[model samples]
Target: MRIAVVGLGAVGARAARQLASTEGVDEVLLRDIDDGRRSEVAASLGAIATPEPQSVTAPPEADAVVLALPAGDHAAAALPLVERGVPVVSTSDSVGDVEALLDLGPLAEAVGTTLVLGAAFSPGLSCLLARHAADLLDDVTEVHVARAGTGGPACAHQHHRALGGSAIDWRNGGWQRRAAGSGRELCWFPDPVGAADCYRAGLPDALLLVNALGPVERVTARLAATRRDRLTARLPMLRRPHPEGVLGAVRAEVRGRVDGRYETVVYGAFDRPGVAAGAVAAVAAVAAVRGDLGVPAGAHGLGASTRARELLGQLAVRGVKSAAFTG
Candidate 1:
């Protein structure tokens, strides 16, 4: 299968690497607006690099496309492929708001293409864990998804934006908007990444999960922060920029009631987060190419559409240790 990975930045580069090396993939094409960086990353991965494109142009008959571009560019980049009945794995939301994310359903079905939206570390894997946890029960009424903040420089800006944006939660049998940071709670992750305060943040998958899981009473997306992140968010004086994407751990926890019993499941990993994030998207892209993912011509997040255990097994084969917890 030929695959095209758009955007060769940190996350994109990682995704490209995985796609190029994964078995059954015949060629990997790299695209970016910057010629220099694009060529460099492509050479390092031994993949073909396209001249800076005028726009996101998927190579003809690519079989599948993996979009590692910014959330803002995802829709435009993927729409061309979707219209052609090609499957897509996007690292982030193409739209800015909850409604925009929800609106992709009709668009995907209309185009007869499959969309694995928000297929990143936290949202991607967290969404998968949510579905798995939900499946363990007859029905799931609530889900709380949390992640450790180890994103790159762009992540700081993203975090600030999430805090300032409206937090969408499931309430009253529907989606409800609340102030960002309004639902702060102390949540425990696996060892070495221990317990920390997780707060509600504006995340697209919260809306996607709501649509996927059905009838959720409450849903929240939170980030696990370090002392540095907290200080940087609040204290202007102490807000010196820290090196990005160097954390040693990444985690996601899903808690809700299943079969009338309260339970929580945690998916934790101890690897450079970029690897896991990219792997999730790359795997979804490959799954789409195989036509075995089981999603039909509509928008779906990686978690909701794919089997959780299968994903965990794939990631495990990559030496990324991820396991579930129950209590």
Candidate 2:
């Protein structure tokens, strides 16, 4: 199958490279508005590169398009391809506008194509963890989620400046926002990465879990930086917004109370922001090409459904792994 990767930024570049190396992909097309970046990746991967999504999708030979663009641009990027009968797998986390995303589902179906959104690391793996936890329990009473990461230089720079330091939580059927520093500090032990500090942050998957598992009385998400300097720099930016470097860890913890017992599962990795994003994009792209993805079209978060496990398991075989931690 032929695959096209949209958005040649950090994550997009990584994803494009990974997809190019995957099995069963006859060709990989890298597209981005940035000419230099596109050319560089194209040369490195020995794949086709273009500046327009239309160019990649126009022929219909490209069976799937993986979107690694900014969260807000997902709908804009996806709608056009879905309308043209191109299946898509995306890493965008724009669940706040469900109605807008759902509006595109039919268009994809009309074209006999599939659209899978929210296929990123956190929502994708995090949601899978929650589902696994739910399956092990007789009843789920409360759920809490926390995540933190140092993104690429741009993302890291933004965090250091305290820009976008807001975290979202879902509980009792509503979404709540909190400052990055508002949650309590908890030390989580993730295998391979070791123990790290995490706090509550706003996460889209928490909301999806609440919808699937029932009303959660308390759900919190958090942020943490591997480098002290980065964390210190981000402290001030909590009061402001800025985008900068990206380098750090992506950590998430989910706690569920079942049958009067509390169980916690943690998922984390120390990786380049672009690398993780690229891995997610690759998985989504492969799933789409193989026609094995279980997600429906529309703008859905990774945790919106239980179908993500199949995708996550595929990713794990490629080097991504999650584990449970105690005290």
Candidate 3:
């Protein structure tokens, strides 16, 4: 099966490389506005190159299309394909332009196209792993997600825009708004990455969880980073990429009563968040092509429609570290 990957940036490039190298992939269309970079990536990956990605069409022949562009650009790249009845997988979130992305639901449904938003790391695999935690409970009561990663420009930008803003959470059976980066909690991660104090933040994944397994107690999304990095977020002009060789991590703590007691279900993953995001997006796109996900028509959160345990299995097989915890 073939998948058209739009953007061809760091994340897009990684996704394309993974897809191209996959055994069953018939082709990987490397698309970008920069013709040179698009062709360069295509040649490097030994795949097709398309400088004009907005013109991509799906179905009746082609497989699926993935959008690795900035959150702001997702709709532009996806609408064209969705309007033509093409299934789309996006890495953007409900942070910026929540309404705009939400509006795509009807559009996709109208044309019978299935749209999966936040298909990247945080909103992507994080969402998947979060649901895995919920599965450990009979009735999910609370979900707290902690994500720590230094992503690409777009992802970093997402972090920048989200900090110090009003964060959304599901509490008391409805959406409540609070100060972003407000509440703080000590969170433990995988070895070498260790633990850090993370703060409440406005993240799309929380909204997704609320929609997926909610009407419950509370849902929170937190982002963790070193003090230096947190300080750096204050200066967008000097935003630096993730240091030389530091991997990223996503951790989720799902709370509920299992059988008759209260407990916490946990999950953790460590990888380069940017590239990991691409891999998640790639897997979702491929599943779309293979009809493996069975996602419904219309825009939906990754956690709401995706089979979390099944997806975690997919991620692990694709070289991503994903697991569940008993303690």
Candidate with best TM-score: 3
Judge candidate 1 at residue 51 and give its lDDT: 32
Model 2 Cα shift for residue 232 (angstroms): 8.9
Better of 1 and 3 by lDDT: 3
How much lDDT does candidate 3 score? 0.75
Which is better, 2 or 3, measured by lDDT? 3
Model 1 per-residue lDDT at 281: 81
lDDT of 2 by residue, 97-184 (tens): 3335556877876677777655555555555556666555666655555445543443344334332356667656676777755555
lDDT of 1 by residue, 157-237 (tens): 566566656667776576777766666688766666767787666767676787677677777677665445544553333
Stretches of candidate 1 exceeding 4 Å from the true structure? 47-61, 93-102, 226-244, 248-262
What global local distance difference test value does model 1 have? 0.69
Clashes of 2: 30
Cα deviation at 137, candidate 3, in Å, is 2.3
Separate clash counts for every candidate: 1, 30, 0
For model 2 the local lDDT of residue 60 reads: 31
How much lDDT does each candidate structure score? 0.69, 0.59, 0.75
